[model samples]
Target: MTEPAADSRTELSSLLHDLHLISSEKPLPPPPLPPITELLARLKEKLIGASSDSETSSLIGHVERLFQTADPDWLFSLTSVNEEGRQEELQAAYRSLVCALIGCADLPLCGDECSSLTPAAYQSVPIRAVPVCSALRALLGALGNWEETGLLWSVAPPVCVFAVTHFQDQVWTNPPSRAAARSLQEALLRAGGWRDSTHLLVGDGRQREEGEEGGKSRGILGGVLDVLQPQLTKDSWQRCEAVKLVFAWTLLQLARPSLSPHLPRLLPPPLLFNDHYRPENCMLGARCLHHIILNTPAADLRQFNRAEVVYEALFKHLYSTETTVIQLVLSCLLDLLLVLEKPPSSLDPSSGRRKPCRHDDLLRLVLIHMEAENKVALRRVYASVLPLLVDRMGVAVCRHLRRVERVVLGYLEVKDPPEETNRLKVLEVLQRMTRAAWPRMQRRRLHMLLRRLLQLMDDVSSDSQLDDLIRDKLMSQTTLCIKLLHDCSPGNAQTLLLQVDSSCCSPEVLGCLETVTMSTER
Candidate 1:
C-alpha cells in the first residue's frame, strides 16, 4: 500500500488533536457538514467507488468533528461506516470512539450509547477482533465472571457476587477467564462503592470503612460491606444507591458461588442472625439471603464446602437460648431450604450436587436441635419453614410424627384451645404439604390429617367474636380449608366427611362448607 502524502497525514493528525481537545474541553458542535441524506450520499459514494480519496478523508474528518463536539445528533453519522467490509476498520475506530466518549461527561454517552446499540449491532461487533470492542466485551463478560471467580479463587468475592444479581444469566451462560474475571471484579469494586458524593465504577479508590477513615486491605467483601452498612439507615438515599451496588454484588456472588466461609469476617455477625420478632429485619435479611440459595444451575457449590460449616455455625442460633437469634435462624433456614428444593435438576445424581446430599439429614438435625425450645419457639420456626417444607416434601415432613419426637410438641399439646393459633398454623402447613404430596401420600395419614385440619378450620370459623384481626385471619383460614377440601378427590373427601361434620362452624361459613362437602360426598 502506498503511504499517504505528508499533507494528508498532517491534516488528519491536526484534526484528531482538535477533536480530542474539543472532546476534552468545551463540547464540539456537530460536524459542519451537509444534512443526513447528504452525509449518507457522500458515504454511499465512497463505498460504491464514486468518491475520490480526498472525499473519503472528508467523511472521516466529519466523523472526527462529531466526536470532538460530543453531539448526539452526530450519532446518526456513525451509521455511515455501518456497512459490510468496513467492519475491521470501524471496530478499531469504535474503541477510540468509546474511550473518547467516556471522557465526555456532558453527553452522557455510556447510557445513551448502550441504548442505541441494538442486540443485532452487539452481535455484529466482533469484540474479540478489535481492541475497543474487546474492552467493551470484557466489561460485559465481567458480570458473569464475578461470581464463579469468587467460588474458584476467593478473589473479588464482593463484586463477583453483586454482578450475579444483575446479570446472572449472562454469567451462567458464558463465564470469563480467571484473570479477566479478576480485572473486571476490581473494576466493579472500584466503580460500585462511594467516595464523598459520587457513585462510580472507577474513581479515586479512597473510601471510608463503616464511617472510619482508614485504608485497610479488608478485601472486596469487607470494603463493600463497610461502604454499605452506612447507607442502609434513614434519610440517605444517595448512600442507599451506593450500598445497592454492594447488595447487587452479593446477589451476583450468590448466583455463582456458595457464600464463602469467610464472609462472616466481612459482615457483622448479628446480620447473619437477625432478630426474629422484628419481622422487618428477618424478612429483609431472609429475602436478601434467598437469592444465595436460589436455583442457579451454573453455580458451583462444592467449591466452598459450607454446608457443614453453615450447619455448625447456625446450630447455635437455631437452638440459641435467646429467642431472637432462634427466630432469625429459622427464617434464614426456611429461605435456604426453598432454594434447595426448586429446579429438581440441581439435585440430579451426577451433577456434582455437593457432599451433604442427604437433605433429609439436615432437616432431621434441625428438628433435633429445636426440640428443647418451647412451643412458641417451635411455632415460630414451623410457621416460617412450613410454606417451603410443604411445597417441597409435602406431608412427608409430618409423617412418622410419633417416632420422631421433639420437646416443643409437649408444650404444644398443653396449650388451651384459645391459643390454638399455633396449632392452626401447623395444620395449615400439614394441609398444604398433604395437598402437594397429593397422590404420593399413604391413605391413612392423609385421611387423619385432613380430618384434623377440617376440625381446626371449624374451630377457627366458630370464633367470630374474637378480635377483628384474629377473626379476619380465621375467616381466611376457613376459605383456604374449603378450597383444599374441594380439590380432594370424591373418594378421599367422602372418607373424611363421615367423621368431621361441617356444622361445627357458624351457619354462614357452613353454608359454603356444605356445598363443598356434599359435592365431595357425591
Candidate 2:
C-alpha cells in the first residue's frame, strides 16, 4: 500500500480503538452516546496524545482483543447522528471509521499462540462485525454520490481491497459461513454501482499509470491477481461453480483497463476452449473483452500479448446458447474489424488455409444470428461487417459480389420507409465497393453495380413529400456512385447520370455530381 493510504488506514484504526476504549472504559450515560462536539474534541485529544504515547501498541492490542466483542454499531450510530445537516463532518468521520473497520478485516492472527483467533478454531462463534463489514461498505457505497464519481473509491481506493482479500482468506480457510457469503453477495452487488465514469485503458506497458503530479495511481488490488486466480477457476474450473456469480463480478471489475494487464494470467488457458470447458468463466472473460474493446484505443491493444485469447474465445462462442454472449462477441469482433487495419492471425485455421482469414469469418459467424427473431441487432452487425470485408479483401471478397449485394440491399426493400440504419449500411457497402473493388472487377459486373446504385438514387416514393433525411442520404449515395463512375469512365458515368433524371437529381446534387464526375484517370 502507498504511504498516504497506509497512514489513512492507521489513523482510522487508531480512532476506532479510541472509540472502543472510551465507550467501554468510561462510566457514563443511561445510554451515554457522546454528543458530536464532545466526541470530536475527545478524538482530537487522543490523536494528539497518540503522537507521543509510548503505550500505543498496548492500546491497539486491547482494541484487537475486543474487536468482535465490542458493539460494531457504536461508530455506525455516532457517525450517522444528524448534526443539523452539517454532512461534511459526518461524512469525513464516517469515511475514517469505515476504512478502519476494513483495516480490522486486514488484521492477521495466524500465529499458533493466538488461540482466540477465529480461523485457529474451526467452530468459533461467528463474529457479527466481521461478516457485516462488507455489507457496511456496500450500504454506505449505495448512499454516497456516484453520479460524478469515477469508480467506487472504496473499491478502487488503495488499501480497502487488501483488507477485503484478507477477509476472503479467512472465509476460505474456515467452515462455510452463510453470513459471510450473504454479506459478500450484497457487497458485490452494490459494489458495481461505483463505476459511473468512463475509463480509458492504457495498453502501453499496462503496468501502472503516472499521475499528473508524478505519483502512481496503482491500487492495492492491481498486482494481486495471483491471490484471485484460484477463485477465478482458471486452475480448476469446476470447484467454484457455487461462487461463480461473485467470481464473475470480481473478475469483471479487475478487467478494467487499469487492472486489465493481468488478464493473460487471470483468464483461462487456451482461451478459445473456455466456452465449453467452463461456461461461466468464459462469459465473464468475454464480457470483459467487450468492455475493453469498447473503451480502449486500438493502437494500444498490441500490448496485450494474449488479445487473441479474447477473439478466439468470442469466436468459438459465436454459436453459444446464450444470446447476450453472441451479441457481445459480435460487438467485440466489429470493433476489432473497424479499429485495426488487418486481421490478427488468431482467426487463421491451423490446417494451413490458402489465405489469411479476414472479416469474412466474422461475417459468416454473424450471419447465423440473422433469423427474423434477431434481425434487429445482427442486422446492424451485418451492415457494418460487409463494408469491412470489402475494404479488407478487395476483389477477393467480390468474387461473388452479387449475392452479397443482394443480402445488403434486401434490407432496404422491407418497409415503405427504410430503416435508416440499414439504408446507411447499404450505402456503406456501395461506398466500399466503389472505393476498393471497382478497379479489379470485370467491367461488365462493375457497370452493372453502378447501374444499380443509379436506380437506388432514383427510387423516389410516388408521393411528392419525401423525408428530408432519406432524401439527403439517397442523393449523397448517388453522388458517391457518380464520383466512382467518373473516376472509372466519365462518358459512361454521364450516361448513368442522365438516367437519374432531374426530379431525383435535385439541382444541388446534380450540380455536385457534375462537378466531381469527370475522368481524372487521364
In model 1, which range of ten residues has the least summed lDDT? 101-110
lDDT of 1: 0.40
Question: CA lDDT, every prediction?
Answer: 0.40, 0.47
Task: Tell me the tens digit of each residue's lDDT in model 1 across 107-176.
Answer: 1112321122224433312221122222323333332322311211122233343333223232111233
Give the local distance difference test score of model 2: 0.47
Provide the TM-score for each candidate, comma-separated: 0.40, 0.49
Write model 2 residue lDDT over 1-522, tens digit each, in one string: 111234333444444446663443333222334443344444434433454324433333333333223233433333444466544555454445334434333334334311234444433323433443444444434433331222233333322333334334343333344445444534433444322211211223234434322112223344234334554443443433223343344445543355445444545532422454445455655665665665555555545544554566567776665655565566666676555435432333555433535466765544434433244655665565556555655645554465555564465554334446766766776677666656654456556666665555555433256687777766676666557756666666656656666765556655655656443433
Worst 10 residues of 2 by lDDT: 194-203
Model 2 misplaced regions, further than 4 Å: 1-131, 134-218, 222-228, 234-261, 269-284, 291-309, 320-324, 334-355, 363-374, 392-403, 416-419, 460-466, 496-522
What TM value does model 2 have? 0.49
Task: Note the clash tally of each candidate.
Answer: 13, 0
Off by over 4 Å in 1: 1-308, 334-358, 365-378, 394-424, 440-443, 475-479, 482-489, 495-505, 518-522
Q: Per-residue lDDT for 74 in model 1?
A: 29
Top TM-score model? 2
